[model samples]
Target: MLKRLALSAALLAAVAGFARAEDVTDKLKTSAAEVLARPAADYVESRVEIKRGDATIVGTLTLPKGAEKPPVVLLLHGFTGSRDELPIEGTKEGVFSRTAHILAARGLASLRIDFTGSGESSGKWEDMTPQGEIVDALAAFDWLKTQTNIDPAKIHVLGWSLGGLVAAHVAAERPVVTATLWAPASNALYNFSHFLGSEAVEKAIASADPDAVIEIKLPWGATTKLKARFFQSLVTVDPVAAISHYSGPLLVIVGTKDTVVTPQPFAGESFLAYHDGPEGLMVLPTDHAFDAFTGPQTVDLMAAASLAFIEGK
Candidate 1:
């Protein structure tokens, strides 16, 4: 009789667990439907100004309608990219902007900011560094915590390319609950060598003038310049080492064809370093930007994947 009672109790517990799971799924579906039923413009949008030392970082904060104290995601852009990311000329939506809107529709709020020297923010591009950007990100986090409509404990950070590196460092040092990296450049020195070539990098490192500019010509014929200090500072930061400090939930999304960051060595290294927490990796057939070779569908796929991870689904 005791054995039969124990079996019955086990069966009851299983049924209760199943019912709870179904209830959560049903709520998610309802939230998604409500988000989809409304247009992007229907969401409440606000301009945010965060003070970082002498400079003011500018950003946009978007919230889903009727969401009370919703979880928020902080979006960070890549090198030479702004808060809007590199918007595809005809459309105003870049990866960050599109992702923010989609997340908002799904009952999530997002804040995408232009790092101190990038976009409309007040600073010189030549003066921006990885450390400085990390400071700006932390400041943004502090600002977000002050918002009455945002849940401070549920803040998530997502970054692409250089921004991804920044996001990792911020997650390690801050109280971030989760972090997502999209084609994060794992090695700063390697990237400098890849873009500027070994000879140029060597010259920049040996140069006595910290302010000396190294002009690198792009494949498209335009030339961009970086200060000597930028390369010098990069040599001090190991992205994998920085990321290892964070034991929270991590999600890494990379492209198989991403010649920019390269998936082989660093991608594997990044996935293995987060040994203390839950980690996920997704590889797409797209390029570094995830939309360079594919259509707009790539953005949708990225948003869906990211939302799934953030929502714990």
Candidate 2:
């Protein structure tokens, strides 16, 4: 009889523990959903198209309501990522989109563009290169300069992943007041070597034809062709060195669990390169795509941190 009673008590405790754990999980999900469900009532979103050389770049500009000559943040997405980072369509809850809305809510304007080959932009994926992205970003910045509603002196640039490197390169040449790099690819050579084996990269580099294409099988089982010039371009440009030239305030945001752009050499080195600028580093407890791998709360945290940095708080 006593053994039966003890077994019943143990089972009850286990069930209660599971129930408690479930309750905690439910709360977290609810909180994260709430953050993503916020409305963008205080901002006006406009679809924009800018001509960059032969390609027509498409994007969105979010301008805050009742703010005259407000500062604008130019957002650049990562490699293979569009102006919207999330895979879901017609949702403004993605990292870049959400950040833009959040910034608008805070009375700041923001512009997010699709690079030539990605999003709604026009170009072949195989033709996209880091150098090309820099050119596209500069074109967007130049276009922003012509906008009468924007404060030219307070223009800022924010880049994520590969886009982070492009943003740094643009800031180096352009007159950006501030720059925020999230999970930036500090070394393109290192990234290429990791994605495409060193042997493949070496062969591409040694090839006589600059237009030679190499077939690369990604981790997600998709095979894509890239030009030999892509690898060559990676070797020529150093993102950290380029970023060092920008005298504006810099904010580096990296995820602690980011294996895509390893925190050690990439994030640490990129953070170290901004020696001349007033720089700040934020290490979040998440992965490379903070919200994608973790949850919406990670994005909420990121948005909060970015807003604080932009507002100089």
Candidate 3:
């Protein structure tokens, strides 16, 4: 019935000269253009696992489509966080996932991993230490460099919180193209002392038992358990000092309201003093995690800055 109605309407229109054949062809052309204007997914992602001596690290790898050996970024999550990170209240995706999509949109690939003891990775959370995370990140970087989809000379590492510290150290250890840190804790021991309490960390270091666990309750009510080495490692591993060895491009992003990494942008900006390469320090008014509590727009802004820096803009 609908087809017959369209036929009868076309016949009437022809007789009345209300519409012309060229006009129908123009309408079809406009509809085709509208269809072509819509955007489609231009990247592919998969769950990948990397084997380490202690435990297996699980992560997501997102790669841009139709790029020859596209540059890739290694995304390291914040302390006690998963690869994708927590979902913003109003959004369906996590911060790292969103970052990966943003990078892919600009023809870059990304790999975001859950450090050992977090997310689906093996090992207990109590054993996590900054030194170990650096090792894990190095392994991931090495793996990325060897992957057929990546350009070995173009791999970058981006991290947040403690992971930012790890990324900085990784840059020092490897020939990374660029390093991006989000609200980084340049001074890990000083930063952790504020939350873990100096007394707790000191007690752990002073303890004679290597198997001893120092349990500290976070303000959010979650308890973090780690060995004395965790604190000791934090004290010994300084990203600001280590970053001096990394002469590649560096981008450090900080939040003014961040209490975890105190003194505003200095926790981030300190890297500039030691580096002799292209670098930038972006300071925003939002809190740690880029105010994920408020909205994801803040993260998007940071992502934009990150892409520009990585692109050498």
Clash count for each candidate, listed in order shown: 0, 0, 0
lDDT of each: 0.75, 0.76, 0.78
Per the 3 Å backbone cut-off, how many clashing residue pairs does candidate 3 have? 0
Better of 2 and 3 by TM-score: 3
In angstroms, give how far residue 228 of model 3 lies from its true place: 2.4
Query: Which run of 10 residues does model 3 get worst, by summed lDDT?
Result: 18-27
Per TM-score, the best of the predicted structures is 3
Which residue pairs clash in candidate 2? none
Compose the digit string of candidate 1's lDDT tens values, residues 197-261: 65677677888998987776664578877788887888887667778888887877777777777
Candidate 3 structure quality by residue, lDDT tens digits, 161-253: 899989989999998889988888877766776656666666777878767777787867888788766776776788888888999888787
Top candidate (lDDT): 3
Q: Which model, 1 or 3, shows the larger TM-score?
A: 3
Ranking by TM-score: 3, 1, 2
